[model samples]
Target: MTKEHILPKWMREEFPELAREPVFQGSQNEHDGPTPDGPRTVYRGGKEESGPFNRQAPVVCGPCNNGWMSQLETNVHEPLSRMIRGLPTVLTSERQAVVALWSAKTLMVAYRAPHFGPRPRPEVILPVDAERLYQDRALGPMMVMGLANYQPTPYAREPLYVQSFTRMEHEGGAYSYCATLRIGHFAAQLVRCPDGMYPPLGQIPPHLVLLRPGASAVHWPPSRPIRAGAEWDSFVNLPEETGT
Candidate 1:
């Protein structure tokens, strides 16, 4: 296995400020049994002192890391950098697909990466999802991706942050998983459900623009931007209530 940096080299080189700051890595695992309210969730994991540039995970093999994953990063460098820096840019349908795939890939790596304290239980992105992503280099039909602009506050200024949530039906069977990734002013959320169980698009908040399963071009910097702290918390946790 090879160690893959959680944040790509291009990203670190472009944003030195983020590369220097210490990152806080954490994970939360939730499980709802077959019975409606049987054991809910236990939040595990803690902070790590490493910066985003230095945070590496020995999850992927050498060939995979140097092959398609490398190409994927290269493909996303230009457009993603612009988005993260809040520069004006339009995303064509093809660009949208690339960004969506990159977002999902990043989330998958973060989920597989090690965290401080105990490792969270019940995998968020299943093995099947990972295999499909690796083979097709695209998000599966069961996955939906959304993008939004993020407004950082003085108290909560982290250039790159990722958080994931998984709801389990039994002990180890996951029903749904949602991962939200924020880089500077750009934010993307990827939600995955079982086959034939896609979430309703109408329930998504107006601030988040649908990226995957969309064909037309998308304009950058949406009219509404999600504010840091409480607003961000609400946006990431909204799937619990709205089923998206």
Candidate 2:
């Protein structure tokens, strides 16, 4: 297997400010259980760390890393750079697809990274999902994507940050896998659910520009912005009932 950088090299070179800044990686697992008042979420063990933003995981094969994955990064370089810099730009339906695909790929790589502690951490994206992604090189219908502008407070700003979580519904045996990624002013979230299951409507914050298969062009800097710190924390950690 070849080592792949979770945060692409181009990103670091383009925004040199991020080269030395620490990146915080964290994961949480939420479960539905009975509480005195009602059913509540039981959060279990999780890991958190702050270290150099440049991280690599030896999880991808040489062909995949050098072939399609590299192409995907190339395809998104220009548009994503603009968005991360908070520059004005329009994301047409086509561009949205590329961004969504790249987001999914990144999330998958992050999930496989060693920072999450060890095995048996909640599995959000299934093995089959990753295989399908590799074969199709596109987002499947089971995945939903959204993008938004992040307004970080001076004290909380970081070059890169990611939070991943899985929500389990005991009654229905349903699972939701989600990850929120932020790079400078650009933020995106991807949710994956089983067939016939959908993410709760309330799970998504209203300010995001939902990226769909055939949707129209979306303007940058959505009307509502996610303020860093509390708002961002809340967005990354969804409520128990929201199915993330």
Candidate 3:
């Protein structure tokens, strides 16, 4: 009944990969992709340290095709009921509200302004309702969906990618959840490049963000009045008994 549980649908569908990757907020706040021939100089704690010099580096100076930048393209107001009508599972209208709210909130967080350089430039323009994402209590909450090991861009240290419980952003402050990643593996570039530098668009290592790793890891949550995970039914099981 508290604010955190009242999220919308956009949050779910858009930020579906939440708590799946190693998410870093301002570490790479520079979403302005660099020119293809660009050379990035990162300091690994001084001492004449250096990292990979990929001309493929993106610039935080301007918006690029990073998937995170496509937030504005998502249909936030779309009804989850209509989206899930064909499913065999059962959900309530009130729960549907929760599902939609969750989804909306997810998308907003995903669409949240991608790191812009020293100025005001958002790589991901965010949903059309940018104002509402932050203002709406149901959508106000935010969470960083990533594996602890998922390294943040521009940082030399490799993310632990270990399973752990982190804070969830809501109106009140932060909340904790027992989360683990289910995205076993993906056809990502799999480059062993030293830390930082992830694709700005689409699921790079497109994997699952499970509620619990190993045991009950899955793509969706249990059905209430609203539903999610059904979106991932094709990839993971969405049986009501399965909790989605």
Scored by lDDT, model 3 comes in at 0.25
lDDT of 2 by residue, 33-130 (tens): 55634665455435454544557888899999999889989989998999888887788888888898999888888878776666444555577877
C-alpha positional error of residue 242 in candidate 2 after TM-score superposition, expressed in Å = 6.7
| Per-candidate TM-score against the hidden true structure | 0.86, 0.86, 0.21
What overall lDDT goes with each candidate model? 0.74, 0.74, 0.25
**Taking the tens digit of each residue's C-alpha lDDT, what string does model 1 give over 1-244?**
9988878998878987776676655555665545664655556556666666776778899999999889989988999999888887688888898899889888888777765345555655677888899888888878888888988887754647555454433333336766778777888888777556766767656687788435889887777889888887777753432233
How far is 61's C-alpha from truth in model 1 (Å)? 2.3
Which residue pairs in candidate 1 collide? Answer: none
lDDT of 3 at 10: 45
Candidate 3: segments with Cα more than 4 A from true spot: 1-88, 110-122, 133-244
User: What is the TM-score of candidate 3?
Assistant: 0.21
Clashing pairs in 2: none
Candidate 3 lDDT, 119-208, residue by residue in tens? 112222223344554345232223223211121233353221211111111122211221222211210011011113222234423342
Give candidate 1's total backbone clashes.
Answer: 0
